[model samples]
Target chain A: MRNRMNQRQECRLTVGTLTDAMRAQSLLSASAIRSEIVGADGVRERREGCGYALTFSCLQEGQVRRILREAGLRRF
Target chain B: MIYLDHAATSFPKPREVLSEMTRCMRFYGGNPGRGSHSLSLAAAEKVYACRRAVAELVGSRHPERLAFTLNATSAINTVVKGLLRTGDHVLISDMEHNAVLRPVARLAREGRITYTVFPTMLLEEGRSPARITARLARLVRPNTRMLICAHASNVCSASLPLEVLGEFCRKRGILFVVDAAQSLGHLPIDVEEMKIDALCAPGHKGLLGPQGSGFFLLGEGVEAETLIEGGSGYHSLEEEMPAEMPERYEAGTLPTPAIAGLLAGIGEVRRMGIDAIHAHECRLIAHLARRLSYLPEVTLYAPQYQGSVLSFGIAGRSAEEVGLALNRMGFCVRAGFHCSALGHRTLGTDATGTVRVSVGYCTTEAQIDALADAAQRLCRRT
Candidate 1:
């Protein structure tokens, strides 16, 4: 169990908007992948707005990207 | 006062809606999508949920396709000014509100576009859909790029057959845009089924949200230029607006509290079932029309299609006088053109307009009865 947990790594896919990040999170969850939206703090600077991304397991990165691209999200 | 001017704005918003707004302002009054803090995320989630709800209401497969706007008027303006290119020709119904009329007219006057008015009034003359389509077939120029119309008349209850119009636009490769100002929550709308490229509606009237809430639902493959450009809470480094939907159009801070309230309002609407609401309101309209029809002075407009609204005028009395008299009787209704000059012109009541009694989900039969009695009393007094 410890070795498996150590082997797993975290991967992030930046989706640009908080809504899209949440949407990606939903799609991943439906596909049995758990993801978290992180990095949304930039308003204190005010010069640059915040950016968000979906953080999930490295094993699910490829599948997540495919799903998001198919859904016409984060196409760039 | 018994509020019947639902076509203008619904009064006595659902309790859930009110509480949701209050909760938003009280608990998590933070700018949505601006930060990762719990409050901002909470607000963002609320806004996203509202977007999903509205998209579902409009039959959109992608929630991202819907964008929050000031009202149906702003949404209509966004689509008209953003979607149509210079030299494009367009068609609108004879019964359109000024929301559709003014924008189209301004574009025409600026030499950016040309337009024609299709005769929806011909439906009153017993014209079939085929006849209506054929007449529109003649009006469509080579440059005709769009057909914009109201889903239902604001001043009356007449609704255009969206399926037929959608089919007509599809065959001709014209964008089908609808202003669902009066019909969004009152009637069922399926953007995909109707081939509607874009739908604009207010959150206030049928959805029972507060005044500053509205949305635009875009069908698949619909594209438009950004009407306004500012902070989209994303891609701040780039000059051009983001290429994706919602964020692409929403260039400023959204009304989080209003959107949260709108979400609750839509949920309530879903719970009550739109069909049941429509049936209840129509029954009331029918009852009132029946009573008012007995009065020789009352003239009902589009009597066959009183969906959730009924428009009538009293003989030898202006709509204003009748409306004021109804108000004095503790009944609230709308008089004059109701911001629908084209509709009034189509009905040939442009001179004095008509008294428009629009209903909502909460409107009661007793109110309708009292309004009918008020109408009768108005005739007797005159």
Candidate 2:
């Protein structure tokens, strides 16, 4: 479990608003991509306006971006 | 205590429902689709799961088509006020509860729409489906835009022939709306099989969920005007509400705790199987009907087994008096018109509405026997 956790990386994706961020999270979940809202100090410093960020595993980063893009979501 | 008022709202909800609701309030306290934080994500997951559960219960392929509402009244209002336009005619059965009747009546009184109420006698048992279909066929006019009916009457438990009506509507391109308030969890409803355009159901009744929880299931190509518009947490920049399935209908902060409870309630229903619950309730209804029919002074309004509800009155005593006596004997039953004056008018009980005893999953055979015995005793006093 430690090795698997180490392999996972956090990726921050900026959304238009908090709602959009949540919608993105739901879409990603439907595609079996596990993600959570970004809460680290570095991520908080990066959040702009009402936009928010999320983190996911590095292995699923590509698939997550692809799904978010298909859902008309943009990354900061 | 024998609580036979399931028709109003189910009591003693499944243990899982209460626990799940408490968990939601304590742990997942976030507005669904309002934020991207972990708590919000968890809350969103619970809401989506609830949507899926409601969709599955009503046999809808697209869970997104289901929209959460405050109750069945809101659901029916969303469909009625949103769909019916000026000069659009509607056909409804005379057995509808006030939830459906009042709104439609208000619209008719406003001259926005004209409605006709068909007699429930056509759908009575032993009546030929062909004859009933023919009668409904003649009632349809060129401007008949929709046919709305309650799946089962709250007053007498008389059920409408949905399959026949659905087929009739499909052939005529009329929208078929069903108020499944009393029948959702008690019977099997297949939207596809019945060609239902929309279904309005409450979670607290047969679904065994908390009050203030219900949903409106919209079939494909069915669209209704937004009843209340505000923040849907989507398309924030746009001044207009998003033209989407659920978001278009759900326009405010949803009751997350109630929805969580509804998810657990649906889970319990699925686990027990709708057929098993129906069988159990039907057995109780049959037993109660048989025993009540034997009393000379007890006038059973619905002597035959219709569904889970049984309405009766004593020959000389008013329904309220009997209901009070039953309450003194530790029986909780619904008295009066049951908010369904039209149904009482149909049953010729508009002057003296019958007492209603509605059974649920928790109701047992012993309770039914006790209720019958109490009714017999009340009759002897009269």
Candidate 3:
């Protein structure tokens, strides 16, 4: 249960548009860093014009950012 | 079967197109720009090559300026909906396909923009490019923001003088957009030389690729609002669509396999040469026109401006009836309005659309003979 709770601790990465968010999600998934598209209801303030966010585990935030940077993605 | 509806979509795509699409599906069935893996990279590379090929075909300076869409309609919609603002005006030709007409018309209906259909006489035979340019200049209004016209009519196959129009638009600071659905691979188009602002074309038609593959190439200093906004694989933390070339317009997962096929199709077109293909289709049209002209019962529409397509009507038979009779004899021809009510209106055949026989790269003299013979017999029976 504790491990499950830890895995559920999510962190969001906001992108400029929906296309970039999807791209970031694809990169994260390929790197084995699980992520989900958070709806505008969940990340309204953080959402860019695309109105979505890639939510991954807090533990994977560093790695996700690194991967996105390596892929030449700009994060908000 | 003799497939003469190349205007609708080219049948029997080049062998390389099929092979390349199959190879991509089997070997690298990965989402492009989605990840950094080898499969993703490979898919991205193939998609990039497709863009590059399209850019090269149109003489575009940058491959990144091209955005792949589902078809020419979608590409045109991206420009029409994204470029024009409320109260702006546009100019189009009377010979435009619905692909160009409907979107612009809808905007006008919604009271966002107003448009005028330039008279067809501008494109009529014997009108020099200079005269057409001057006539178009007269049609432009102070609010005229853009001019959109098809490179060639899908119904009557009337080739528009795009270079002259492009030059006129450039001088007037009016954006020039071309719907190259019928002319992309059948005729040579130089976006740079023509000063074209944006060009839209379908890969499935003249390019000899599968359906669901089309693109829009943008010229320098031209930008439009994003029509469909979603994940673009970059600038992931912004609340707005990215201010980029293709990523600004291309959203969601692209059709990868179809794009792969389109890349090969472009390659084959390059190898065969567009001029050769155009010459062959023109020859076929010329033969068909000559034979049909001898038929007293057939009224050929715009036969003098024959390009790759020929439209005609029988005296006693509807376009549909003649099309059906020809189909029964195993010749595929498109009947009815050919999705261009505006074109039919110009041809005075809006009520009874003309039968459109469009030839392709693979269409032969023998096929043209067969079509002519079938039409002659049908005319006699009627």
Candidate 3, B1-382: lDDT as tens digits? 7899999999879899999999999998788766545686578768877887898888975776789999999999998888999999999988899998999999999999999998757235667777777677788899999999999998876888888889889988999999999999999999999999999999999998899999998887789998888987655675787787677888888999999999999999999999999999999999999999999999988888758999999998888988898889998999999989889888888999999999988999999998899888888797
| Model 1, span B1-382: residue lDDT tens | 8999998998889999999999999998888877667888789889998988998887777888899999999999999999999999999999999999999999999999999999885335666778778888999999999999999988778888899999999999999999999998899999988999999999998998999999898887889998899987766777999877888899889999999999999998999999999999899888888989999988998777758889999998999988888888898899998998899888888998899998899999898888888888888877
TM-score of 1: 0.94
On TM-score, the leading prediction is 1
For every candidate, the chain B TM-score is 0.98, 0.97, 0.98
Which regions of candidate 2 fall more than 4 Å away from where they truly are?
Answer: A1-76, B122-126
> What global local distance difference test value does model 1 have?
0.85
- Pairwise lDDT winner, candidates 1 and 3: 1
Best by lDDT: 1
lDDT of each: 0.85, 0.83, 0.84
DockQ of 2: 0.15
Task: Name the weakest run of 10 consecutive residues (lDDT summed) in model 1 chain B.
Answer: B121-130
User: Candidates' DockQ values?
Assistant: 0.38, 0.15, 0.06
lDDT of 2 by residue, B1-382 (tens): 7899999999889999999999999999798877657787689778888887887777777677789999999999999999999999999888889999999999999999999997767225666657767778888899999999999989876788889989999999999999999998999999989999999999998899999899899998999999999997655666988776687888899999999999999998899988999899988998998999899887777656468998988888888988999999999999999999788888888999999999999899999999999988887887
Clashing pairs in 2: none
